[model samples]
Target: MVRRARPVLSSLGPVTLDRTGVEPLHRQLYRALRQAVIEGRLRPGERLPPTRALADEWGLSRNTVVTAYDTLLAEGYITGKVGAGSFVASALPDAPPQGGPGRGDARRGVGLSRRGVALAAVGGDMRDPSGRPFALGTPDLNAFPFAVWAQLLARSWRVAGRGLAVDPDPLGHPPLRAAIAGYLRAVRAVRCEADQVVIVSGAQQGLSLVAQLLLDPGDSVWVENPGWPGNRAALLGAGARLVPVPLDHEGIDVEEGVRRGGDARLALVTPSHQFPLGVTMSLRRRLQLLDWAAARDAWIVEDDYDSEFRYAGPPLAALQGLDGAGRVLYVGSFSKALFPALRLGYVVVPPDLVGAVRAARRHFDGGTSIVPQAALHRFMADGHFAAHLRAMRALYADKRAGFLRTLDRCFAGLGRAEAGEAGLHALVHLPEDRPDRTLSALAKRVGLTVPALSDYYTASERRAAGEEPVGNGLMLGFAAHEAEALDRAARELADLAAAMA
Candidate 1:
């Protein structure tokens, strides 16, 4: 074979080219030169050696060097003189000198608003990670047919084409919305057309959207006392003052909410299965709430979270379905069913408010991913979702039974299973004196997750009055874990509680 041409030596800054690298030779050269210029390693207006000479030095073709030089010139990294070699552009790219904030301008960490600071405080740390056994609010992800979901997702890309790839409707994918409407009608008795359902990232986003549209700054919004932290934060972020109403066994005490904030513009209540406490709103209570809302010209935000896997009697009818006055804005999430990462949920709004809700969604989040929406449409159409829910209900029922049995075996007093063993978690009552915080901390130390019920309440002092929060209890999750695993963990938790006692 003929010997390779010897490289002509040229004076330039160090640029060791790796021939074995996956990056193109021209790109590597371009990057090296760019870095040198940006870092000021190459002084401004410094002339570069002829490409022909540099090419030989780097063991690359003359064309490769020419391409790099051309790119640099085109991108303003360097200038080319017809008769002369490439020169580093006089004005180079570099940050302002380090000193004051603007002098070293960073994109972030600069003059954050009060809202930003408040949001920043909202939590990065999780109470339990690695899907801690008996953790509340977590679904049994193993039960979800992820492989089937993946196939459907891939199929959506192939079949749906460019539309699926582009920015979808801020409201939602029409097909998915239609499917959701039908599902709601058949199962939850929530009557609504496809247009009435605005797809959101989750229940949280749905709540936020409602808050943004309906709630003005300083507007009052009633929420459950021992309610979800996300709901509280979302309302607070929207500048809505919370009216923390006490909950009875009949769910949110409407009279108490009225007494606290009767003039409140909005009421965010979880009627089907109250969070932390797990009380289903009585029919009378539901009517009372509806009447109160209608009388005050106030809106009710019905968060129907975790009504799917109810181990008790038939699933309770959604407040939205029963609503004759169109006062309730119904919210539900798939996090408890499919998985939290999916981040797909919907808010069924009345006909009048749909446009405003959709507009708010556009400003908040342009739209949810079309691929998942399409996949969900397919999942619902194929009966896989229903089948999965059926299987999970049975599985969760057994797990709930195991947890209750553990409570009976290991603990003294009777611990009531909320809504007669509905949802993913159960409420185990502790003595009034046993500080729930101490119990929660002690449980956490043993690698067990038992969320204190009283912690859900927001007040100056510890306790809530009038059978509210129903007092000291542990909100133990039972659905995420398998029956045997839950049994072991619950027993171990009981042992920890006993030892502490």
Candidate 2:
């Protein structure tokens, strides 16, 4: 019986390169390394020397070693892990196949592209959280005038008959575009025409399209440090190198963004009501961001995700309203205003970018469904959208007040609430001794859905860069719940905190 080869501890014996040979150094190194692996001299699971160390020891350039290592990694002869350096493939080609179902396991031997791996790492819990206590980003579906919406949808289907089945314009349904354009101009103060509005499935899809259209691989992008995690996956999948800019009372710290990635090709922000934290960008900061974008010849994606639910003075004009240089791509969604299943949103691009965005949209799902577009257009054109917003604003205002009162009564010393003037949710900053994740798990046990604020922020990345971490807190959502539900949930959470103490 033949014996299996033993794995080497380190070093690939003594690899010699013929400097005078016609073969390129990287290719020669790759060949020699491949032959060693094939002959079992560098057996499976053996660690490869660091490229820099290998280069120094072998008298070769670091790039040559990297290229050789990369070739081995790409061909599956070796594996590279983040922070863990390269290692020889554990399942070498010569290994006997495992038996039965174990050999056919879907999790085994599944090789993903770099982008796929990145997307895989971006974890999200997409289960419907409607009616769940403290659920984030969900609207009060019970308050929606569904009878009216259903009527509008039925009318849309009847009017759009055969047309609804046909391929839609990549830009959008023309009338829906016109409706969205008018609504934005009147409400958000955004300056745009119907021709500039491109319909998408949702805000996430809008950001994804923006990333694909505006960003190239390795391009620097300024993202809010404790920003929306949903956008991170999209931006990263598009190959953007994210520069997490810190936030202040004025919103995204423009000066800090400049310091971190002054030459960033794009900036993604939630200027209206910053998510998770809900700090409105001051006018001065908004101007600074616009100026920076314009000066750098960069683009800004303004995500007005849930600004319509503001319980304060007057509604803040969108950042896009302040842009004169045509640098801002305004993205809005109906999910927060209407419902998640609607899956509809729109982007108002600069005139110059309209064609490109449309082209990109054509290839990305062939534009949103025409029937929903028509229904939403009817809903908005007939003033139902305005009425709905007004009702939701009042309902959410009361809910927020009651929830704050409950938090004050129940969680006096345990947590402090940042009751921002806007947003459907509030951030309750937990004491340093009480980590948000521990509290979050406790809340989960009692059927509450509060999430840790640190999950939204790249805490590890910030720590690695020697920056102060964003504060620990729980994001308690109130919009979707009745006041009684929110109050009960908050009291239960406070009980857990008290017990924890």
Candidate 3:
């Protein structure tokens, strides 16, 4: 393993850099040295400390010390002669600009790049305050088998050998891929081979990778009106014009989506269970979407997030299973099942796209780390994964029941809970007059965050023309907390609704 070199920072210098701070240590040291030189604190012609000496004195890496000195030399702030140490340059290159771009107040803050600006404008703002009770879109982390996981992780690392040294397969760890392929076949009834599964950091990364691989600029993409925010943001970032397809009781309206997005090249759908408003896609609807994608030469990115924890009804096969033409790209994540921090996800593509996706992954994502992949493989191989899933399903079933009951007791008829028999969250529809955005903010003030359903609707003009009112609801998550905590959160939501009403 390559360990980061330590820094040898001292209080004696004009500037002290925090090792843990987000700013790079080299950048911080460079700024400090530059400022000190410009202010004449370090006299002209004075020799700076040797890189070795400074590194030893401040517990910093010699390279960090050298880089800082090198930057100063390159910028004319310092000079060096062969066999002589570096010294502050007697004559500087140019005077600091008095009034240039980002002068005065602008200079006080760091500016973001164009890409950074765009991402920030549409980024998610999730908070896990107050021990993360009822936190949406997160698994029940407290129930994870950390001890068993640690054992598996240690074993994988010890036996790593070549895996630790060699460049990883961009597709994934082989055994882990095999494990996932087996699980998908036996459990989800998805048709895939181990070689076709491409492991990723998470479904979010998988979504972005799929877009990068397939989408073109200005290409139309069909998205659910009130859909997964991550997918919507990613599609927008990929330069796809998002046409919001409204949802019906069966799932995303396939006919409506195609009617609106006739020229669309891609579609993102959560078919097993719709997000926010939980509803399984009917077979006819699935087939219709499949037909549309196959006929139009478009790709369907099937996000089967949290498909393992079904609490009621018959099991539903993955949309990819029924996809005969290989148009569906199935994506899933361990974030919702295992834990968010695990950051493990997989994408099962068609046989034809496997090599293309795998070859592209080396250049783009470069696959996920091998350690976690190996550990997860062992976790599944040992039957711990299945056992964990069973326990979590029961736990969430109770949490969901308790949550709905509390809502019934506290604020009956005020909000409607829309949830399928599975998944981590449920959507509570608020009255039309209520600003779901404001209600979400009010809930967050007390450390309980419920996402506003309206924020998921991107097509303003289309929604206005629709017969049904624009989506106004609270996307409540019940899987993360215990019964007591869920009840408390429900009471809080009720109180907020009453007060706001």
Query: Per model, how many backbone clashes are there?
Result: 0, 0, 7
- Tens-digit lDDT string for candidate 2 (1-501): 322222222445655666776657888788778768866888888888889887876677999999888666644577766788988877553222211123333553356566656565554542236467888878889889899999998999987778888998998899999999988898889999999999999998999998998899989999998888789889988998889898999999999999989999999999888887888899999999999999999999999988888888878899999999999999999998999889999899999998888788777778888888999999999999999899889888988888888888888988898678888888888887787766775565456777878767764645746666767888888888777777778888888777756
- Leading candidate by TM-score: 2
- What TM value does model 2 have? 0.78
For candidate 3, the per-residue lDDT at 128 reads 50
Give candidate 1 regions above 4 Å deviation: 1-127, 413-419, 461-470
Report clash pairs, candidate 3: 6-60, 7-59, 7-60, 8-58, 8-59, 8-60, 9-58
Give the TM-score of each candidate: 0.74, 0.78, 0.75
- Residue runs of model 3 more than 4 Å from their true location after superposition: 1-118, 126-130, 464-468
Pairwise TM-score winner, candidates 1 and 2: 2
* TM-score ranking, high to low: 2, 3, 1
Which of 1 and 3 is ahead in TM-score? 3
> For residues 1-501, could you state the per-residue lDDT of candidate 1 as single tens digits?
222333232333556666766657788778777767767777788888888777766667999998788666644567665678778878752222111223222443567554444444332222354677757677878778999999999998889878887788999999999999999998899979999998888888888888888888889888888778778878878877777888888988888888878999999998888887778899999999999888888999999988898877878789988888999999999988899889999999999998787677778779887788999999999999999999999888877777777777767552444435478777778775565655665565456777777657764233423443346778777767776777777678777666544
Q: Report residue 487 deviation for candidate 2 (angstroms).
A: 1.5
lDDT of 2: 0.81
Q: Residue 32 of model 2: what lDDT?
A: 73
lDDT of 3 by residue, 60-119 (tens): 798988878866764567776667898877866332311122322253235744333334
Best by lDDT: 2
Query: Considering lDDT, where higher is better, how would the candidates rank from best to worst?
Result: 2, 3, 1
